[model samples]
Target: MYAALTSLHWVYLLFIILIIGVMVLRRDTTLVCIIGIFLLGLIATSSLTTALTGVFSSLIYAITQLLGTILVISIIVSLSHIMTHTGINEVMISPFTRLIKTPNHAFWIIGLLMMVVSFFFWPSPAIALLGVVLLPVALRVGLPALGAAIAMNLFGHGIALSGDYVIQGAPKLTADAAGIPVDQVIQASIPLVIVMGLVTTITAFIFMKRDMKRGILTVTSTDLQHFDEQMNQRKAPLSKGLRLFFAVLIPILLILDVVGMIIFHLQGGDATALIGGTIIFILMAISLTAYKNKGLEKITDYLINGFQFGFKVFGPVIPIAAFFYMGDAGFIDVFGKTLPAHSQGIVNDLGNALAHIAPVNTEVATATLTVVGVITGLDGSGFSGISLAGSIAHLFSATLGEGIATLTALGQLAGIWVGGGTLVPWALIPAAAICNVDAFELARRNLIPVIFGLIVTTIVAMFLV
Candidate 1:
């Protein structure tokens, strides 16, 4: 039984390596991941029908797991789209342009603003809120669009989403999978999150400065120019009074939402639901006030557009996520009664095997968990592999004793940093699209800082653990 389980674990690892290989080659891994699910099911259950059904079942499971994130993103996007029509979106950020008189200023302001906003509203909505309004300012101030993209991607996706301190989505997932309290995961992640954020953001800023000194900090693309022109094409039909009212009112409302979270101690889904509820109300108010009698029609249009964007972004991720989800013990219900009764999950089994086969020490455990987190992130959905990370962290903790939270936090950080948006092209789309730069190029730019941050963070994690 042990040998068979270990062999199955090796198969899972083999598929993970293959997925990463394809991603490194700049190829899509959706098909490869689907095949992996089928093969794993076939080997585990010894039934072709089970394997085939598992493919569909896994996809459904992945979608179900991701639906909340998808809905929140869609609603936020819809809100952003509505605000754009009223020109309030532009009004909302125009004040920041004054501070961005230089490339360095633009980088810091954009990056910092994105981080804060993403922490509250998530990167997807935050990108939609800031991209059109800030990209032009950053460009005019001598920051290359690519640099601006890097700033947003690094700060928002890498920092805010990785730690997920405010909303606690990442920690919730990791903690739940690890069978630990969410607060424990969040507490353990704080220092590592700061370290990772500071190291990566500072490194990126340095790179941007160097690029600027070399006279390479220019956006020469006509596409960017076109995008800017299109953004500016919509005029603020509202009076200055109205625009100013909303500009101040909107921030206050969002800030209040943050305050509510803090006062009520809401975390994870509750916090997200709060933000989502606020955005919906904001969307309704904007549609009704701006579009008048046409408000209903306009709101529907925005929602449809938002859902379209949301699903489009999520489409390629589903199959890839499905494969990784199977490696988590939490999804056994999703896969029905097919899984072996004693199976702890492929990733958990791997961790157990590694613990027994090797000298289980802090460094080895830390490295293995980090690597597993990184591997799970290959699907380009950082949250998908976190449960696996949590499960494996639990297994390793049992062997090593103590520091489960620290190891789990480390795995969470690694998974999110790689797969969240910085290192993956598909995941970087919101930031890239907003900045009017190539997602692949943005990923390339973020690679060095993120990897270095991960290494430094892992070392720090060893000490903490």
Candidate 2:
């Protein structure tokens, strides 16, 4: 049953507005979000003490909800780090280098290779792996470094991270906030990810081809020299047999995991567990064999570094997530007895009220959610605003009466594609730095294609749901 909107509900709405306002100004909303939580709790319980405790309680609650995602990402990053040290990562990508005989070939190979590697180890590390090995090949074959960067940004960050099929961190965050299972979010994202990836990447390739025809897309001599110097200076040694073993073993193992997921009907936590377990064994086996005497110590070191990276990424997200969680019914457990009996989630109530007063049509809802997702992405972390996207998608779905999964997936693609790395100059640093291009310029080059991608994907989503 839906409860009537209360003063607390109105206050919650104001805070949401303020949070968005702060994000628009490109400022961190963590403090604003914490204040919002405190004030909302104070109004709800009419107790300063409860409000103060609720701040910490809500953060702990958010962390609890997201711990699984954080852990999985951390462990995967750890395994990736070990792979790099053992030189297995290089082995994995060596085959792709042979295909880069032309600029057009370079573009597709680099983009596809980056996308596949990023799906497993994430885009940041994938950039490091691909940039060193493949970038020079692309440049030598006539593809500009800028084109390579754009391809990596669109394919890796826009495609892989948006869907996050392997790691599932993004979907886990969105699904938890939306009160849905992680698998549902993943399944919903499949079509949307495909559409976004194709539209943005293809549009970018066309623009790149046109630029090349005008003689404006050539890699400069200075950049090529710089890249050559960097490449010569960075080489790590590993046994040939070991490299080949992992190069072949890793993909087969990961593929089997995917096959298992299909055959056993595994999804969500079960699917993630399978992936995580495989990585653990891989990490252990590699560390032991690669560093016989120091393997045990190295494993601990990798795990520590991985978790540090993982929590660091989620740090800003915690407060933002805490604020949004307060708007969900599930957070009642976090607040103990503070919430009133029969209380509805703030977001849910707002959705119900809107549905009753001025019901949103499917097109309007899709456009509005996409806009909201983009706005939330302005903070540039790509993740800070995802909880809000999930919450709002849940609300929109309730009002629209269908396509909850599709709408949530659409919001995820919008938020991640914009803020994850493409539109945000700051988030574009990894791809930009590796390619030796200006982050702002990369973002600028990415703007048109990404926007077109979002528009096309949203339209396609309207049909699917």
The top-ranked prediction according to TM-score is: 2
**Per-residue lDDT of 1-465 in model 1, one digit per residue for the tens?**
442364567777788778767754556777888898888877777789988988888888877766766777788778766766677867778878899998889889999999987876678778877888888777776788889889998899888988887656678767766767788998899999999999999998898788878887676667467667978686766666776787788779878988998899876677778877887888777787777898889788888998997787667667766776777653465445444446666665666666677768999889987887787677687765666677678778866768899999999999989988989788888888877788998898899999899899999999998
lDDT score, candidate 1: 0.79
For residues 180-211, write the lDDT of model 2, one tens digit per residue: 88888889999999999999999999999999
| TM of each candidate vs. truth | 0.82, 0.95
Candidate 2: Cα lDDT at 61: 88
Task: Sum up the clashes in candidate 2.
Answer: 0
In the predicted model 1, the residue pairs found to clash are none
- Candidate 1 residues lying further than 4 Å off, grouped into runs, are 1-61, 166-169, 172-182, 218-231, 316-332, 335-350, 373-388, 424-433, 436-444
* Candidate models: Cα lDDT each: 0.79, 0.86
Question: lDDT of model 1 at residue 346?
Answer: 63
